[model samples]
Target: MPLALYLLAVAVFAMGTSEFMLAGLLPDIAAALDVSLGTAGLLTSAFAAGMVVGAPLMAALSRRWPARTCLLGFVLLFAGAHVVGALTASFAVLLITRITAALANAGFLAVALTVAATLVPTDRKGRAVAVLLSGTTVAMIAGVPAGAALGVLLGWRAPFWAIALLCLPAAVGVTKVVPNPAGDGPGQGRRPSLRSEFAQLTNPGLVLTMLVGALVNGASFATITYVAPVVISTAGMGELWVPIVLLLFGFGSFIGVAVAGRLSDRHPEAVIGVGGPLLLLGWVAMASVATEPAALVLSVFVQGALSFGVGSTLIARVLYQAAGAPTMGGSYATAALNIGAAGGPAIAAASLGAHAGALGPVWASSLLTAVAMVIALPSLRVIAPGAGEATR
Candidate 1:
């Protein structure tokens, strides 16, 4: 890999850290801001909601500028947002900062995937995008653990500060290494209205692929927020060991992503079909581990691996479905992933509040997998893989 590739990866790592670290620090933030944990969670909601709004908006406006500058600007916005998040005295001001940072966060990642595809040879595009996106896995498996530790040991403000620290180096790295052409990227000018971009999105196959992405992501995140609690409570583990088990889960998650990326390029639907069920089984197993600590750890491992691994296939599938209009498909996938992250938790929260146990998320996860399985069936009846370049 080129050294410059690492630069893009750095930006992703920083962005992923910014997105995931907040969950760990929510209580501290809530306490400091004189708000409830539920209220502090609005920070995550605000970020997701902002992505739904900001992704296409940024994609549209930034097309007139060079891709490098746009990415750098978004990083700067991300950094400044975190700075305000760390320093602001008032909850309202902090909320505003999060929204701003988060909007930039979504826009940055949306373009980053497209940019990554351009950075390398066409043959390596699959893995290249995977490597860049792998930062999310790293941030979740590694950054979150450290950030959460920092937040708990130092204070809630400490994690965002740590994020900003990481961001400074990453911002400089991306600026130094990522190429800045004098004009827009290849084929950029032809991009029509966001409506035109989305018009292609209505294709039955593409919509189904996106639904697979959304439902899987939503179920994963929704249940994930409570995984540690489930492990400790249901598995009857010592409280001190929660982080260790969570670390194991994270390790499985990132490794899954790396493997799935390579696999998706070969057999997209096969990858998802296998991955989705593994994840469903993982969830079911996780729910049933009320008496077996050993079983809980095993479930977490499988959960991390399969849930995120399937994502590579899911994303690649959407891009393929969009045919010639990849940018729109990419942006749509970004939005769908965000929606899933939000939707799954919302469902889990509402249901878990009722009489259900961990089974609530487990069954919900299973239902989603079933839906994705049905919807993600073969779309190319006449033309399959390696049938020559797709003409749509």
Candidate 2:
């Protein structure tokens, strides 16, 4: 609840807007660049690839720098990339811009999480993280829709211009408000070596927690990526109502994170153990009620809440397990989440291809989330010795 934490959330809001807004702009981009929709879609893939590669690389590179410096540098780089992207018409140039932006995005998030974790006591870390991550839900609720409207009313490039402008204030906020934590100065305890950082992965609890993060995100995206089509074809909603459905999901996400933040502090195990099974049930409900408008709306809300609730706990779990390498731990979590976001859609698409229904993705999501919960349940023993007592 430090002002710096809110500033970090503002920074994250800009990054999340840029990342999610692209989905709504792809068609305009494809037409403008004279590329196929499939080719333009590669922009998203390129960004995800950059995130996977950049998180650890950038975190390692900036290990010796002050956390404030690293954050300021990444935010500036991110803003600059958006400016270039806004000016570009060529598909290849735009792709490069997205990749560059994503690298900076990854760096910003890893450092932000590290900073947030350090800003509070051990018990409050989960709430602090939730405050930072609420930016994503806010972006989904407001930014994406606004960007889509801007694209339709003005042009595809308009969203990029707005994103670039948004980043400037966030950059300034970080520069002006975020404190440089004491002892994070250059030449702080021997810089984290790549070997030691990678060694953290050897801890089975940390690795499993990271995997759970991936699976949680993957499951959510599997259904989310195709939600618009499902709403239209299955629920009989008009195309114009798609945004409303997404807004409901976003609202649920916001509430979920708010609840998870407090609950994670009091009962981390319940966040996973109880929330995970509910997420699976939510997906199953979605599949069962795909054609029922009222039922589907409720299902969407439940799915969103449970997905993010479980996700926030997975994040806190990884942070706990990877206490030895906090920065690297955050990077690993970011990488795992992006990997799931990228992979879940692909898997769902394949299932749809084979089964031919809106429910296909829902079923796929159910299976993935169920497996994630199973992986998470046993790992509670490894990550928290008091989890049993806490849950009871």
Candidate 3:
């Protein structure tokens, strides 16, 4: 991978840390801001909403700008938002900062996906993307915990300041490394018009590709959203084991993504076809053995590996299918993943509200993954017989 890809991943790490770290600081934020915990949780919802809406909106608005310029602006904007968030005393101001930060994060991710793909050869696009996305998995493993510790030591607002500081190096790196899309690169030449970009939305292959991505991601999140409950209540584990279980899941995900990156370019459809069924089975296993502590822990790791392995493959497929519309392709990919991230927890919460036990999230994951497979398997046969490379 290029140094530019690593620099992009550095930026992603800072943003991902800010995105997930808030979960640990919500209680502190609520107390400090004189708001209810439920109200403070709205900050998270606002960020998710911003990502879903901002991915495409920001991408389109910045479509004509140079890739380097867009990335630099987004990174600096993200840092500035965090700085403001750290200094704000009003809950409303802090909430707005989260939304602004999320918008910047979404735009950065969208453009980064396109830039990463273009930075590599057609065959290595999946690996390039995997390298880029590895930042998030790393964040889950390291950054979130560090942020939580920072919050505990220096107070909740401290992590926000740290995140803003982290972005400074990322901004400097982006400005120095990222190439202009219009320069002598794979993304060079005539840009697609807005009309042509919209036309790709009607591509059946691209639509199915994104749908599969969303459903798979939704299934992953449904289980992950309630992982603590499943580990504690369902499996009767001690509270101390929660972090251990989560760490296992994160480590597994990192391994899965790395492995999938190597295979995705060569066996994209075959990997997804096999991994999807296994992922559904993994969820079912979790639901069935919810009370078995050993089985439950193992299941979490296996499911994480399978979920990200398949999920990353599907996203690579989306990029390939929507390759003609470079600007909109990443937007569609970012929006689909964020949609899943938002919807999965809502469905899981509903399942719990209906008197389902701790296993409800596992069941929800199973159903969603099964649906993804049903849609994806047949579609792959029709659209991806030899579809490793971009189609148009």
Candidate 4:
């Protein structure tokens, strides 16, 4: 809606790209660094770990600073980490750099959500958040693939260099476009106490909303983390086609977010009431028809769609329920999502390790989504009926 929101989206795009591009570059990184694939993959784990811790910590630390200043500072830190990552030859150095970048990315995203909500009308907070998160969908559709191609053409480090370059303009844009709103200035009212921030979690509605967000995200990533292998072994597709299928998933995610943005404004609960079941069904469909190429393609698309479709509403719900602690709300949402991102894959991997077939992840993800739906059903009654429309 506002230019500042768009600039926030740009910052998100750069951060999202960094977060996912590593998935496509793991093989190259493993080989280049003379490490096992599993070790290189830990880089992703490190990043997720950083995000799980950094979001609330940064939010607490920056409580007295202007949102614009926190955003700019975090982006600069992220960019500097990317530069270090790009130059590092040792795997240990790269791992540390990725963690640092993730911490900055987490802080940037948490602040961006709060800032985006502030920039819009109460009725439009969902759409505003959707606009900000669309950057991640766009990154999935374009940035990851492009970074993979860049890695293929040059080296795994090239993508980091590109990410570093991308952050420069985002940092400048935030400084120039985003406002330092009243009450966010330095020496404003007393900083939010740790006890007060944690009190937000005492709200059953907010807590349930966070759990649902985590479960939904965990289910999605459970399948996505191992999609290439699942497609190849189960669908009988060649390796080259994996990227195309992933592209379809990304495209579906983009559409899902666009639609969710509108629906969340009108019927936020429906995101879970309807979209959650759809997500579970999508996963079940994939598990049932994993060997059929057509079915696999359709299932992936549907899974991606429903996985993301409910995301905007989840954020809106948290914002509504935790209105008094908006910054903490944003941070908590980010942390919950990252927790799922990390946990989902671990569960999927364990299922596979237990001799489950290529469809193991599909089954695992379905169970998680079903749990999310069960959680969502009761939580809807806990949130104030009109809370979605109330601005704190």
Candidate 5:
């Protein structure tokens, strides 16, 4: 609700765009760099690896720094990395840039989550997080598509420049709007030591909650990583229809996140329990209808809504369970989410490599969602009692 939160969302938009736009640019990059498509794809994996490693490492190292300072520094660093990436001719240099940018992005997100919680009351934390994550949905709807268009029309390097430029305004806004005093959490500026903060990892509830987050997100990326190809080959759609289907999914995700923000605070159980099973059903339906244009299109929207709704709710649950660690709590969520981002697509790729049909990713998504539900629904009692009720 605060201006700071919106500014944080804007910053996240640039980061999300950089992260997701590559799926559409890999071919151009591969050709330009004189490498195989598989090697160019490693750029994406590098970013995820940086996110997973940098989340906790950067969060812990920057714990003593002012929150606003950390955010500003990371934003500038990310923008600078993009500039270097755009100028580079060597694939190795571009790879380093992706890693550097992802580290900055990860650190920024970790601090931003903690800062968002401190900006609002305990009851509104879920909504605050939703507002922050909506940036990603918007990126899916507009940024990735636009980046692809730019790459096609202006060259693959154009989107990199655009991403760098996009961050400038967000960097300026972060300097102006985000309060400098909110370093990590409230109090006399007392900072917890690494030993004490890392101790939160020992909590079974928090660990399970993180695992739930990873599994749910893995399910999401599993399908989404392959959605474009599925839409083209399976649904018999033209290139124009690819972005249309993706736009529908993104719009559905926006609506889903809005609902999650409203309900997750008090009724996390309902949000996850109902949404998780429905998401699994959506994936099953998606696989069955993959060859049907109308049915597949409709299923994508429903799948997006259900997948993000449950995934966002699980993030709120992880943050709550890791509340004792404040800044590190965001790192926990970030690592879990990125772990899924990396692993899910790898699984889907393997399935496709095994000569599974165009629908392989959909079935992979279903299995992952089922695994997530099996892990999550039964342990809701231990991992996520309603916020309004007592925690076990």
Candidate 6:
């Protein structure tokens, strides 16, 4: 709700848009750059791998700088990557640029979250991170669809150029608006030892929590990477309408993300418990789409809704696991998120492309989503019967 948060959100929206638009435009990008679709898919891999590598490394190193300066520098780096990516002609060049941008994005995302939490009261931590993160979800709703549309109209590179333009002022806005919350510099405060980071992570609850996050993300990407093509080939939709359908999928997510924080206050586990079923039903429905457009649309919407529905619970879930060590716990969650981001695409690609067998990506995602939910149930039970605020 703070203007500072909103500015950070703006930068997040642009970064997220650039990050995800590749999924919707994979075929176009491959053709433009003279590469295989699978090879182009590695574009996502490059970015995710960078995030996994950058999140903790940057978060740890930036401990010495004011959070405001760190954010501003990252945003400039963010904008610069897009500009470079937009201009590159060789495949290797584009790949390098994407990695650089993601490195910047990874640092910005983790640090902004750490800084934002300092701006709000403890009771509001979940809501604060949730709102800040929802900017990424909002991009899924509006930005990805819009970027896909632009790609269809202006070539795949155009969206990168647009992201560069969008990020330019967002960098300025963050420097001008976000308040500097005090941060314990590197090697200051009660810094968690390597032993502490390792020990806390070994806890079963936190481990399962992250595993579920990885599986869910893998489920979503494996199916979504091919969604546009599926609609075009299987559902007989027009090329012009692909992004519109994608938008419908994300519109459902946009609504779910907006409500998730408020719902967490009253019913966290109950909602988390139901996510797997919705994903299963969504795939079942998507399978029947050739004969049922309405059902297909509904399925995609439901998939978006429940996929994100459970996603909202992630930060709080981490807080619960950390128990007494909020800062360490928070860092663990961010790191897990990046780890998932890194691993999901490789797993999804293997499942969808080579071993997909008869049922294909939709069924694969559905099966995995169910597994994620089953695994998450026991982890959710670890939360104090009361809200997490006491220990969180």
- Per-residue lDDT of model 3, residues 1-392, tens digit only: 89999999999999988987888899999999999999999999999999999998988898877888889999999999999999999999999999999999999999999888888887777798789888888888888889989999999989999999999999999988888866421245577787898799898998888888989989988888788888888888998888788778888888889999998888787788888899999999889887999988888889889988888888877788778888777888888888888888888878876566777888998989989888988888644546434433
Cα deviation of 130, candidate 6, in Å: 2.4
lDDT, model 2:
0.83
Candidate 3 Cα errors over 4 Å, as ranges: 183-187, 387-392
- For candidate 4, what is the lDDT? 0.83
- Of the pair 1 and 3, which is ahead by TM-score? 3
Clashing pairs in 4: none
Expressed as tens digits, the lDDT of each residue in 1-392 for candidate 5 is 89999999999999999999998999999999999999999999999899999999989888877888889999999999999999999999999999999999999999888888778887877888899999888898889999999999999999999999999999999999988763343211566767988999999999998998898899899888888779998889988888899889998888899899999888888888888889988899999888899998899898888888988888878788887887688888888888888899889887786566777888898999899889888898876687765232
Of candidate 3, the 10-residue stretch with the lowest lDDT total is 383-392
Name the runs in model 2 displaced over 4 angstroms: 184-192, 384-392
TM-score of each: 0.91, 0.96, 0.97, 0.96, 0.96, 0.86
The better-scoring model by lDDT among 4 and 6 is 4
In candidate 5 the C-alpha lDDT for residue 73 amounts to 92
Instruction: Write one digit per residue (lDDT tens) for candidate 1, span 198-277.
Output: 68866776777777888888877777766665666666678877777767767887888788778665555466766777
Q: Model 4 — which ten-residue stretch has the worst lDDT?
A: 383-392
lDDT score, candidate 6: 0.70
Which runs in model 4 stand beyond 4 Å of their true positions? Answer: 185-192, 383-392
Candidate 2 — number of clashing residue pairs?
0
Better of 4 and 5 by TM-score: 5
Poorest 10 consecutive residues by lDDT, candidate 1: 382-391
lDDT string for model 6 (54-92, tens) is 777776666667677878988998889888888887889
Which stretches of model 1 miss by more than 4 angstroms?
A: 181-195, 378-392
Question: lDDT tens digits, residues 1-392, model 2?
Answer: 99889988988998898898899999989999999999999999898889888988888787777888999999999989989998987889999999999999998888788778778876777788899999998998999899999999999999988988888888888888887765653223444666887899999988888888899889988888889878999899899878888988888988999999988867777787788888888888889888998999888887888888778777877777767785676787778778888888888988887665777888889889888878877777665445433333
Greater-lDDT candidate between 3 and 6: 3
- Per-candidate local distance difference test: 0.72, 0.83, 0.86, 0.83, 0.88, 0.70
